[model samples]
Target: MTDPNEVDFAHTDAADRKRREKATGLARYIWERDISGAELLDLPDAQLRKLAREAGVNPPSTRETWTVVAELLDEKSRWAAAHPGHPQATPTHSDEKIMWIKRPITPWT
Candidate 1:
Protein backbone atom coordinates (compact mmCIF):
# COMPACT_ATOMS: atom_id res chain seq x y z
CA MET A 1 0.00 0.00 0.00
CA THR A 2 1.22 3.56 -0.78
CA ASP A 3 1.83 5.96 2.03
CA PRO A 4 -0.58 8.90 2.22
CA ASN A 5 2.34 11.27 2.80
CA GLU A 6 4.04 10.30 -0.45
CA VAL A 7 3.89 12.85 -3.26
CA ASP A 8 2.91 11.74 -6.76
CA PHE A 9 5.83 12.84 -8.93
CA ALA A 10 4.28 11.21 -12.00
CA HIS A 11 1.18 13.38 -11.80
CA THR A 12 3.24 16.51 -11.26
CA ASP A 13 5.50 15.69 -14.21
CA ALA A 14 2.52 14.96 -16.44
CA ALA A 15 0.95 18.32 -15.62
CA ASP A 16 4.22 20.10 -16.38
CA ARG A 17 4.52 18.23 -19.68
CA LYS A 18 1.00 19.22 -20.67
CA ARG A 19 1.70 22.87 -19.88
CA ARG A 20 4.85 22.82 -22.00
CA GLU A 21 2.96 21.22 -24.87
CA LYS A 22 0.39 24.01 -24.82
CA ALA A 23 3.11 26.65 -24.75
CA THR A 24 4.93 25.03 -27.66
CA GLY A 25 1.71 24.90 -29.67
CA LEU A 26 1.08 28.59 -29.07
CA ALA A 27 4.62 29.44 -30.11
CA ARG A 28 4.24 27.44 -33.30
CA TYR A 29 0.95 29.11 -34.18
CA ILE A 30 2.47 32.54 -33.68
CA TRP A 31 5.71 31.91 -35.57
CA GLU A 32 4.25 29.87 -38.40
CA ARG A 33 1.93 32.67 -39.53
CA ASP A 34 4.33 35.53 -38.72
CA ILE A 35 1.66 36.93 -36.42
CA SER A 36 3.67 39.60 -34.69
CA GLY A 37 2.57 43.05 -33.56
CA ALA A 38 4.06 44.89 -36.53
CA GLU A 39 2.62 42.42 -39.02
CA LEU A 40 -0.80 42.74 -37.39
CA LEU A 41 -0.86 46.42 -38.33
CA ASP A 42 -1.10 45.41 -42.00
CA LEU A 43 -4.29 43.46 -41.37
CA PRO A 44 -7.72 44.91 -42.08
CA ASP A 45 -9.64 46.68 -39.27
CA ALA A 46 -12.23 43.91 -39.16
CA GLN A 47 -9.52 41.29 -38.74
CA LEU A 48 -7.78 43.37 -36.09
CA ARG A 49 -10.99 43.62 -34.07
CA LYS A 50 -11.50 39.89 -34.41
CA LEU A 51 -7.98 39.26 -33.16
CA ALA A 52 -8.56 41.59 -30.21
CA ARG A 53 -11.60 39.57 -29.22
CA GLU A 54 -9.63 36.36 -29.56
CA ALA A 55 -6.86 37.85 -27.41
CA GLY A 56 -9.37 38.35 -24.57
CA VAL A 57 -9.62 42.11 -24.94
CA ASN A 58 -13.35 42.27 -25.48
CA PRO A 59 -14.86 45.59 -26.55
CA PRO A 60 -11.52 47.34 -26.67
CA SER A 61 -11.66 50.82 -25.15
CA THR A 62 -11.09 52.33 -28.56
CA ARG A 63 -11.54 51.17 -32.15
CA GLU A 64 -8.15 52.61 -33.01
CA THR A 65 -5.99 49.95 -34.66
CA TRP A 66 -2.91 50.87 -32.66
CA THR A 67 -4.72 50.37 -29.37
CA VAL A 68 -5.70 46.83 -30.23
CA VAL A 69 -2.27 46.16 -31.69
CA ALA A 70 -0.56 47.28 -28.48
CA GLU A 71 -2.83 45.12 -26.34
CA LEU A 72 -2.29 42.07 -28.52
CA LEU A 73 1.47 42.62 -28.50
CA ASP A 74 1.43 42.95 -24.72
CA GLU A 75 -0.52 39.72 -24.42
CA LYS A 76 1.98 37.96 -26.68
CA SER A 77 4.92 39.28 -24.68
CA ARG A 78 3.31 38.15 -21.43
CA TRP A 79 2.73 34.66 -22.76
CA ALA A 80 6.33 34.42 -23.98
CA ALA A 81 7.65 35.56 -20.62
CA ALA A 82 5.51 33.04 -18.74
CA HIS A 83 6.43 30.16 -21.01
CA PRO A 84 10.15 30.34 -21.23
CA GLY A 85 11.91 27.74 -23.43
CA HIS A 86 8.84 27.08 -25.55
CA PRO A 87 9.88 25.44 -28.81
CA GLN A 88 9.77 27.64 -31.93
CA ALA A 89 9.12 25.34 -34.81
CA THR A 90 11.02 26.10 -38.01
CA PRO A 91 8.63 26.17 -40.92
CA THR A 92 9.61 24.14 -43.99
CA HIS A 93 8.49 24.40 -47.62
CA SER A 94 5.75 21.89 -46.94
CA ASP A 95 4.56 23.95 -44.01
CA GLU A 96 4.47 27.04 -46.20
CA LYS A 97 2.51 25.19 -48.88
CA ILE A 98 0.05 23.94 -46.31
CA MET A 99 -0.36 27.46 -44.94
CA TRP A 100 -0.90 28.80 -48.44
CA ILE A 101 -3.58 26.21 -49.07
CA LYS A 102 -5.33 27.04 -45.80
CA ARG A 103 -5.19 30.81 -46.30
CA PRO A 104 -8.51 32.54 -46.86
CA ILE A 105 -9.26 33.37 -50.48
CA THR A 106 -9.36 37.13 -50.71
CA PRO A 107 -10.54 39.29 -53.61
CA TRP A 108 -6.94 40.39 -54.10
CA THR A 109 -5.64 36.83 -54.19
Candidate 2:
Protein backbone atom coordinates (compact mmCIF):
# COMPACT_ATOMS: atom_id res chain seq x y z
CA MET A 1 0.00 0.00 0.00
CA THR A 2 1.12 3.52 -0.75
CA ASP A 3 1.72 5.44 2.41
CA PRO A 4 0.31 8.95 2.27
CA ASN A 5 3.24 10.19 4.34
CA GLU A 6 5.59 8.77 1.75
CA VAL A 7 7.27 11.36 -0.38
CA ASP A 8 10.32 11.80 -2.56
CA PHE A 9 11.85 14.43 -0.30
CA ALA A 10 14.60 14.95 -2.79
CA HIS A 11 11.98 16.51 -5.02
CA THR A 12 10.34 18.44 -2.22
CA ASP A 13 10.49 22.23 -2.04
CA ALA A 14 14.03 23.40 -1.34
CA ALA A 15 12.94 25.70 1.46
CA ASP A 16 11.42 22.83 3.36
CA ARG A 17 14.54 20.75 2.96
CA LYS A 18 16.70 23.58 4.23
CA ARG A 19 14.50 24.12 7.23
CA ARG A 20 14.62 20.47 8.09
CA GLU A 21 18.37 20.45 7.76
CA LYS A 22 18.69 23.45 10.03
CA ALA A 23 16.41 21.95 12.60
CA THR A 24 18.32 18.70 12.60
CA GLY A 25 21.58 20.56 13.08
CA LEU A 26 20.18 22.17 16.15
CA ALA A 27 18.86 18.88 17.47
CA ARG A 28 22.29 17.32 17.03
CA TYR A 29 23.91 20.00 19.18
CA ILE A 30 21.74 19.00 22.10
CA TRP A 31 22.77 15.36 21.97
CA GLU A 32 26.28 15.68 20.60
CA ARG A 33 27.17 18.32 23.20
CA ASP A 34 26.14 15.93 25.99
CA ILE A 35 24.03 18.57 27.72
CA SER A 36 20.61 17.00 27.39
CA GLY A 37 20.46 15.60 30.90
CA ALA A 38 22.09 18.46 32.77
CA GLU A 39 20.49 21.35 30.94
CA LEU A 40 17.11 19.83 31.47
CA LEU A 41 17.64 20.60 35.14
CA ASP A 42 20.52 22.86 36.23
CA LEU A 43 20.81 25.53 33.55
CA PRO A 44 19.59 29.03 34.19
CA ASP A 45 16.48 30.10 32.31
CA ALA A 46 18.26 32.45 29.89
CA GLN A 47 21.01 30.05 28.91
CA LEU A 48 18.55 27.26 28.51
CA ARG A 49 16.46 29.40 26.23
CA LYS A 50 19.48 30.27 24.15
CA LEU A 51 20.50 26.66 23.82
CA ALA A 52 17.04 25.68 22.80
CA ARG A 53 16.94 28.30 20.07
CA GLU A 54 20.33 27.25 18.79
CA ALA A 55 18.94 23.77 18.60
CA GLY A 56 16.19 25.14 16.35
CA VAL A 57 13.61 24.49 18.99
CA ASN A 58 10.53 26.70 18.91
CA PRO A 59 8.19 26.33 21.82
CA PRO A 60 6.82 28.22 24.77
CA SER A 61 8.85 26.23 27.30
CA THR A 62 11.69 23.76 27.72
CA ARG A 63 9.30 20.85 27.86
CA GLU A 64 7.87 21.90 24.52
CA THR A 65 11.41 22.13 23.16
CA TRP A 66 11.57 18.36 23.38
CA THR A 67 8.83 18.04 20.83
CA VAL A 68 10.79 20.16 18.39
CA VAL A 69 13.88 18.07 19.00
CA ALA A 70 11.90 14.92 18.39
CA GLU A 71 10.50 16.29 15.15
CA LEU A 72 13.98 17.04 13.84
CA LEU A 73 15.29 13.61 14.75
CA ASP A 74 12.30 11.92 13.22
CA GLU A 75 12.66 13.86 9.99
CA LYS A 76 16.34 13.00 9.85
CA SER A 77 15.76 9.28 10.30
CA ARG A 78 13.26 9.31 7.46
CA TRP A 79 15.92 9.94 4.83
CA ALA A 80 17.56 6.58 5.50
CA ALA A 81 14.80 5.20 3.32
CA ALA A 82 14.54 6.80 -0.12
CA HIS A 83 11.26 4.99 -0.72
CA PRO A 84 8.15 3.89 1.14
CA GLY A 85 6.44 0.61 2.14
CA HIS A 86 9.15 0.25 4.75
CA PRO A 87 10.05 1.85 8.06
CA GLN A 88 12.07 5.06 8.11
CA ALA A 89 12.52 5.40 11.87
CA THR A 90 11.57 3.52 14.96
CA PRO A 91 10.04 6.46 16.78
CA THR A 92 9.02 5.98 20.36
CA HIS A 93 5.31 5.97 20.96
CA SER A 94 3.82 7.88 23.89
CA ASP A 95 4.65 4.80 25.93
CA GLU A 96 8.31 5.05 24.81
CA LYS A 97 8.23 1.82 22.87
CA ILE A 98 11.35 0.71 21.01
CA MET A 99 10.00 0.13 17.52
CA TRP A 100 12.86 0.55 15.07
CA ILE A 101 14.13 -2.16 12.75
CA LYS A 102 17.34 -3.54 14.22
CA ARG A 103 18.49 -5.08 10.97
CA PRO A 104 17.35 -4.21 7.51
CA ILE A 105 15.31 -6.79 5.69
CA THR A 106 16.82 -8.41 2.63
CA PRO A 107 15.53 -7.39 -0.77
CA TRP A 108 14.18 -10.89 -1.01
CA THR A 109 12.08 -10.25 2.11
In model 2, pairs of residues that clash are none
lDDT of 2 by residue, 77-107 (tens): 4543455444533222313111111235678
Per-model TM against the reference: 0.31, 0.30
lDDT of 1 by residue, 39-103 (tens): 54555677645544543444333334343444555566667667767753232223543322245
lDDT of 2 at 10: 44
TM-score of the candidate numbered 2? 0.30
lDDT of each: 0.48, 0.48
Off by over 4 Å in 1: 1-34, 61-68, 71-109
Which candidate should be chosen as best, given lDDT against the real structure?
1
Runs in model 2 lying further than 4 Å from the true structure: 1-27, 59-109
